[model samples]
Target chain A: MKPLLDLSVYLVLGPQDCPGQDPVDIATAAATSGASVIQLRDKRGTTREQVQLAQRLMTALEPLNVPLIVNDRIDVALAVNADGVHVGQEDMDASKVRELIGPDKLLGLSVSTQSELDAADLEACDYLGIGACFPTISKDDAAQVGMQNFRHLTEQATLPVVGIGGISLANAAQVISAGADGVAVISAICGAPDVSAATKELSSIVAARKDLG
Target chain B: MKPLLDLSVYLVLGPQDCPGQDPVDIATAAATSGASVIQLRDKRGTTREQVQLAQRLMTALEPLNVPLIVNDRIDVALAVNADGVHVGQEDMDASKVRELIGPDKLLGLSVSTQSELDAADLEACDYLGIGACFPTISKDDAAQVGMQNFRHLTEQATLPVVGIGGISLANAAQVISAGADGVAVISAICGAPDVSAATKELSSIVAARKDLG
Candidate 1:
């Protein structure tokens, strides 16, 4: 088993999601302010950009002792020696990804459906992200897995769980209260006018929930 | 060794390049009209879209006997059981891609510079894509390797060579005459008003050049 991550305020940002600001700067700010984990999910850039930016991100986050997770593209994750890789149902199977990524690197699998959650090989990934806890703009097709389903799935997950998709400051506490280790958010922090402040607020919320528990 | 492909008109199309038309429709038309190979280079769609579309493309082209090569994303290629995969200098290392895809699947590596060509592990891939034979739009960053340099690389290359970038009916024969087996094109066939006519014309040019040789 991999070392457990704090999972609180897991910020998922990319070139496509960052808009006008540089992703590195956004990630740097989020990391320093309290984001425990960072995931690079660039859906719009070229393969070169993905690899290059990920290298930069690894360097940026290394000193902070925070882990950088690559979304979907294991090539970039392996090339950059990132902390982990997160895959959806459509990407390479968790078992194959684990075999290729090997034992040391962290692996995260997203489970949006009960069958998918039920069928996920327990040995493949270090953690599970269950969502769309609410409607999400990032993945418009994601079936709304409502808070009730999110709680149910989290209860059944063998590994640590995080709430993904459409999570924000307004309701991030709800995700933790429902028994997840953290909330994986995109726009709430990446699109925030003040990224650092947004991250601090979100992290405190999850930290507080864990403290309460 | 992977079987040497009939390199005549290699059509590189993707959801991003096909514009108003469905990528499948465009690929089918080009394949039937004489495109010897088809590579899906989608830098735009989601991972699910990439895999699902590539699967549909494989079924569509299997009967026509054209190979479907996925660009950059090896996971999609492996998931869909694609005939092959094409990678650029920035994607996964050719040797590593070869290692994962194994011996049977065709592997193509793109070399835009002399250093990349010189360092390329010749035994790793079945073929190489060399170019921006002219100023090409598909990848604006591709270095413009004029015909002189393109021919030099092709001559030095141990594997079959295909000219990629800015190739069209007007300039494809030049690529063939330059010693490359075929022209790997994107906009010329995918963006053409008549996809079938464009493919037939481009394929004939390559065939004619080989005949003259």
Candidate 2:
């Protein structure tokens, strides 16, 4: 059985944030530095490219024992034997993804509102990507969940929570302190001048806040 | 109002197949050369990148009057205001996508068997992408529908049928003859040494066969 994931400093990489960079390399840098998990979030590229990238990332991450999660495309995740997949409200639901990926793989759901959270089959997901904690360019339509709502939502969530959207070292601790088990970032680590350093800082911050609890 | 998609000579572009080519350029070439509809099937890349590519394809295809259909990512389709989204069984269901994209946009569902076809809420789909009429390297998991199954399925399908998976200039006419209104191709167009020429040839073959009907 695959080990349960540590959601701390989860790195979400997309081509938009890491233009001209190999996704595997960017993920390797972050995973090696401190990111606990890596989620490949490509909304464009063929199944072949996605599978190839996932395979490369799996090769790189498996030795580190870091889990590679594919976002939105379960077929790509399965094709490359990735550790898991993450889906948003607009993507396939968690139950269906669970059935497809099976029980061994981690399944993540993106939740923004209390009603959505209430309706979610919590048993189907390993973690919840609770997002838009602040306005984010990562997702233009992501509704901001703000600190208060984020805290409330996390407090009630049975599944682990990884705060996403606009997360960075500067505010990651705040999100963790607000009750998220970790912070999921896109541009913060992906577009940073030094990805490893950025990941380390975010990891330390999330760790410190979690330690405080 | 977006013009009703011709659904003839539909081109499906994937980053893996295109290699170094820009999706917009390939889509433009295909559209101008006689492709009737363009489906951007990027199984990888961030939502931002997908939306940007869809926007570029929309810009390239709009004047030519070819509809741009996004594969799987409803958020990206909505973000760029593209013509529609195409989803497979493992992806989001057509009904949910229809609810999200609304009645104004096109919605396509991929069906490989009679049971899948029966389970499908046909009213929710604007068209059906039916196939694997032969073995297809494009989707490793696609079950070959063969000409007989393709003909039977298309005969019963109330929605327009676009045969996909392994469809090529050599076999496209056969699929059209089998009852598909069109053929959705990936490698046959995107990987060709000359995309426009390839698209033109396939379009002519499909048109000629379609004309016979």
Candidate 3:
């Protein structure tokens, strides 16, 4: 059986965004403060370093029962024994990732437009990371998916949706209100002065909005 | 211009091999002791972790001017601005990795037999990781490519060849004598009590044999 995914306040950590902080510390803080899922999203680093960090993060997260998701790098995911992986349009296709990761692990795909959603094999993915709900510095190339489109895409997707791209406490509720099951942020948490506080604030907003439904 | 790849004494690091050793420390020790290329091979961990690790390894390797190669993760390679990527036959096709990594970065492909070599897009690859010269615990599924087949594959390849799978200082000379430009090893180095000494020993053997040519 596939494992359950907690999409609420999903935090995607980027080393570039964290600067002085260790990824493990940031992840632990986020998880402790109620970030439902933590996706490690490094675009730089050797696979060995990645695995080392993942092992460290896993040690911190396991006690909290927060699932650790890897972004791309199925080999790393398999090596670290992560809960799942998230892939972008340029990364391996969702179906192939599903085949490699198998039925048990969670697989999330990024989709910014209706066409991408149409092309994606929803059955292969446990959830959809849909957006740049707004323009995002987190990903310079991310095509903007305005509130209307974000809502439309969320409604259209058969899988659960986590709104990504430029998401913050100020705008996160809007995404949840627009029908996103959760909001995924990078800098909002990683770049925060206090990662735990940032995560807590976002989690409360998501919870409040989710409760309204 | 793209950075030159030493290929000689190529080291592939696996998380399983280094229980307590930091990959960066191992890589640094290996590079300092004359391992020409370092390939980070992790079958687990998130992409973020991999990139972070790669960045650290890159920092350790940069001053020594050693190239850092990622195993089976073009996205991580691209994100970390790694020197190149190595892909197995079961992973992304070499042509696609070539296109994504572009003209400058090195791209290596793994081939176990002549058929696999013939099927590969040679123009897209800078080198071939030809294996398993002997049965290997590093990868349980690796098909054995005894010395004769290893020689045959090396002779058939147009690109530089690195004989992998069960390579060690004891047998590494045999692979170099079989026309391999280098040897790629996992446990042989990472599992060593002294990674630098292991790398130095392997480098000396590979060098002496290559000198015979």
Candidate 4:
């Protein structure tokens, strides 16, 4: 069995997400406030740069007891011993990742369409991130799954589901109420003026919803 | 102790090296014609593309008994279970790479300068690739080590040496004379109209030099 992951208010970030601010600082602040986990989704840059950043993030998040999840690059995740690795529809095959990362590490897979959800290997994944819960611009190619579809998928998912893409304090409560175990955000906290404040608000909403659940 | 390597003629290739030809075909033909080893040094494309290419190359070279070495990307090398991984002085640290690859996999490091040679962890490396034998245009940043420096460095190396970068039939003999255990080439074989013929000539030169020694 894989170790438990507290994925509530999961923060997804990258160099592209943080242009003026430091990602480590943002991640640290987000975790301190209420982010349960963080994913380093770097699409561009050399492997050396990615490794250094992941190492720093892992060290910073260690004391906070927050998991540092890496996106796409399994090597970086393995090199730094990140808590888990997250892959999308286009990334490496989830089964290969599970084999390389071994049984102990957490593995998360993205699901949007009914086909993708149906095809996902639940045994290999610790959690499933389902959404594009709203239409905002973190990713250009994200498959849009609004609140109704998001709720429908979350209900059918055997594994824990984290609603991602465009989630914020405004709709985080709705996401949780709709049956999602957590809400994963990219720009919500990282792009906010007060990263900690944004995280705190989202966490409260999740807490309130969980109390009712 | 490390396993004895057959370092007669090593072929280094990437998509950039093969313009009109397929890299797998070139590597396969080169290995059959007498290239002792092959390294997939891909610099462009997505990790998906790199992994697929590496897997194909490994399968193609396995029957020929030519070891496939992946440069810079430890994940691709690990994903495909290639014979080993090769990194340059500017790539991942040799010690870390050795730890990730574990003891059995072949690890090769690029040592073009005396300082690099001095700093190299010989205990962790199966071989050292030293070069830029005549300064042709395979890589613009390659350290240009003419015959004299090549001989000097090759003689000083405790690990087996494969002279790489800009090496071809004309100067492969000279590299062998310079005490290199093998010759690694990019454009020489991959770019040749007849890759097998070019590899055969280089292999013969290396074999003749070894017989004389």
Candidate 5:
């Protein structure tokens, strides 16, 4: 599958309380509002529960045609028939995943270093997700890849590149200008009081940049 | 959970035609003969097929108390109730996986460089699966870490370290002498004609190191 050229926002859902965040609700809201890719990333849930949630989210986002990516889960993704699966630097090897999923399905790899990029068969993958642009509570142990790494890697990648981790509207443009094809936001969209409004504003940033070419 | 200390002989499965050997049958034979860890490393299946194979392998190996480590699918590992999941530098973040799967599950991360080793949090993981101690075709892009990198990382890790990628009984002692808790093999025990005998010899090597203290 050819990767989308527009900036894709990955909505991160943290559980309720610790500052009033809701993952499913936020993702639903983001999808309805126009987030290109709505990925479910709740790392702490039973397989049954995670699959059910992914199914519901896949159904919820169907109308928008916004791809639902199950974070680090091939089973849940396959069970839910999600649009794709997002694996990290410590997840499954992308080439192996591509072989398992076939060439038509989208398989994304999280790369934090140049060696990983060199190691991957770019032809087999749809895109590369680079991240933690800023430290975020979503993944505390995310490596310090920094914005420069983002720019360099994205520029170097043969496939589309999505920037993840702690991304918000405030820095989305900078990440895009840094050469990322898309920006995957977690807390920024999920935590917004009005997800629809937040997505509209974020989407417009990517949409408005078409004239830059 | 504390890792099993006495367990030895890491066996990996490979494809039949490639690398002039078959990894799956080798791994199966090794498991039947009492190998400690049997890893399914087929990088050629789709997500659905991979999960199915993992499920089948888990069922096959469960009776022997042999831990089945999936090459890189935490979701598949969780799906199959696999003993654990092994990942490389291009996979998911190990700490994130620990959070997703909880502390009780086993999470092993692959390390090929001193930088990656130094960056990883020793406390978050159950063990370190280090490797490609020599050149081999089990993995197409196997990065030869040389003996020095192996020695350096294993010495620094507080957790049990398993050497992987092209490890054979011929030089299994080198990995152990370097402070590795175990050595992971791909085509070694898996492709041998007398699988049981191959594993027994490898196990003895891992065992003979008792005098190292």
Candidate 6:
């Protein structure tokens, strides 16, 4: 049931020049290059080595079950119980990480403004990892909310935003025609030579704009 | 030589009701009851038990030297390299926590609004904790910013705000005359029966309101 949320073309893999790509080989090469949602931001390990690399990237995405999110360690996403956590606007406050990753998990919140996406609460989140959008070499980015702040925060959000930090595939359909419901990248699938054809050309350009109307 | 920044009072002691309280006995009982700065919120350990309770609350406040903030575990405040890390408006972007707590650490971000303190970056922080100020039993609240948003984020801040949830001592000098430079508490110094006379009655009503201004 929670498997159909295809977090829409999102991918962020960096641990320095893909240093022999790990997190279960970058979540099995960004879930067979259609990168739906696989963030394992490795800020130099040790929560028992990021919960043994989020338990070998949740047992190598247990055959593309695709949902291994764990960026800012909510206790190594509750000690390797990964599948939720992306917090950043300065961390821990989407109603306290939805009361410590509970209400059916998967809480993400890395917005860039529009007053922290209207001081975020978005019903204790399920999505909204907004962005750095343009100014990024991957990191050391301070402020750069471009793509016209993704059509003014997906035309005033109601949850489900994605679009994080310097998305690629040549501006990924101009950030999904400026109202992203998805598009997050880190050096386009960890500086791809071919992370499954750059995540199947940004998931077939977000599945051919999945009814953007 | 860092002790004068003590904006009155702020405390929170609950790690199984204090006994040899960690984070240097909840920051030397909030700097011997006249607390200037001491944020050590340990949400049930293990980053090696909150880096050995922030290295035994930074060695029991290294001879009462105050300033020891480490709430959202930035690698246990850079591994007991405590003296800065409050983060929350949602945790890591007061300029990437002032670039991983650099430029001589001490970041603190949490502003509720006034457009996240006017899209804060107010020189990448040194203060601005603001808060719940009134309605809080505390399990990580995120939408209460009242008391007229403490006179509109204290006339649209310039940093140095610190008002935190449910402050006591009967609303502690009306949250330091609603321009708060300090007034943080958790059931007034860990539900005081005398946490140093409730930290000297909220530090003598925020130092007798500078003789009522």
Index of the highest-TM-score prediction: 4
Q: What DockQ do the predictions score, one after another?
A: 0.28, 0.05, 0.07, 0.46, 0.06, 0.02
DockQ of 2: 0.05
Tens digit of per-residue lDDT, candidate 6, span A1-213 = 334566788776635637676546765877876777788776665344565667777778757878878876775666566777777765556675666557776878777879878888888877887777777876674477877866888788887787777678887777777878778887877777877888898888877876664
Per-residue lDDT over A1-213 for candidate 4, one digit per residue giving the tens place of the 0 to 100 score: 454688778999998999988899999999999899899998876777888999999999999888888998888888898888999977777888898899888999999988899998888999999999988798888978889999899999999999988887788888999999899999889889899899999999999998999
**lDDT (Cα, tens digit) per residue for candidate 2, span A50-150:** 66677889999999999999998765676577899898887765776677678999989999999999989899999998978988998787999899999
Model no. 3, DockQ: 0.07
Whole-structure CA lDDT of model 5: 0.72
Clashing pairs in 2: A42-B44, A42-B45, A43-B45, A44-B44, A45-B42, A45-B43
Q: Clashes in model 4: which pairs?
A: none
Candidate 3, superposed: residue stretches over 4 Å from native: B1-213
Interface RMSD of 2: 9.3
lDDT string, candidate 1, B24-47, tens digits: 999999999999999998876667
DockQ of 4: 0.46
RMSD (Cα, Å) for all candidates, in order, is: 4.7, 13.0, 15.3, 2.5, 15.1, 18.8
Q: What is the RMSD, in Å, between candidate 3 and the native fold over all Cα?
A: 15.3
Better model by TM-score, 1 or 6?
Answer: 1
- Whole-model lDDT values for every prediction: 0.88, 0.85, 0.85, 0.88, 0.72, 0.71
Report the Cα lDDT for residue A135, model 4: 81
- Greater lDDT among 2 and 5 belongs to 2
- List ranges where model 6 is wrong by over 4 Å: A1-12, A15-29, A33-39, A44-65, A75-192, A197-213, B1-7, B11-22, B36-38, B41-46, B49-70, B73-115, B118-153, B156-178, B181-205, B210-213
Ranking of all predicted structures according to TM-score, beginning with the best and ending with the worst:
4, 1, 3, 2, 5, 6
**Candidate 2 CAPRI assessment class:** incorrect
List the lowest-lDDT window of 10 residues for candidate 6 chain A: A42-51
TM-scores of the candidates are: 0.75, 0.56, 0.56, 0.91, 0.53, 0.34
User: Runs in model 5 with CA error above 4 Å?
Assistant: A1-213, B1-7, B14-25
Which prediction has more favorable DockQ, 4 or 5?
Answer: 4
Expressed as tens digits, the lDDT of each residue in B38-103 for candidate 2 is: 998876665546656787888888889899898877656765778988888876657666766778
Residue B141 deviation, candidate 4, in Å? 4.1
Once superposed on the true structure, which residue ranges of model 4 sit more than 4 Å away at CA? Answer: A1-3, B1-4, B134-136, B145-147, B211-213
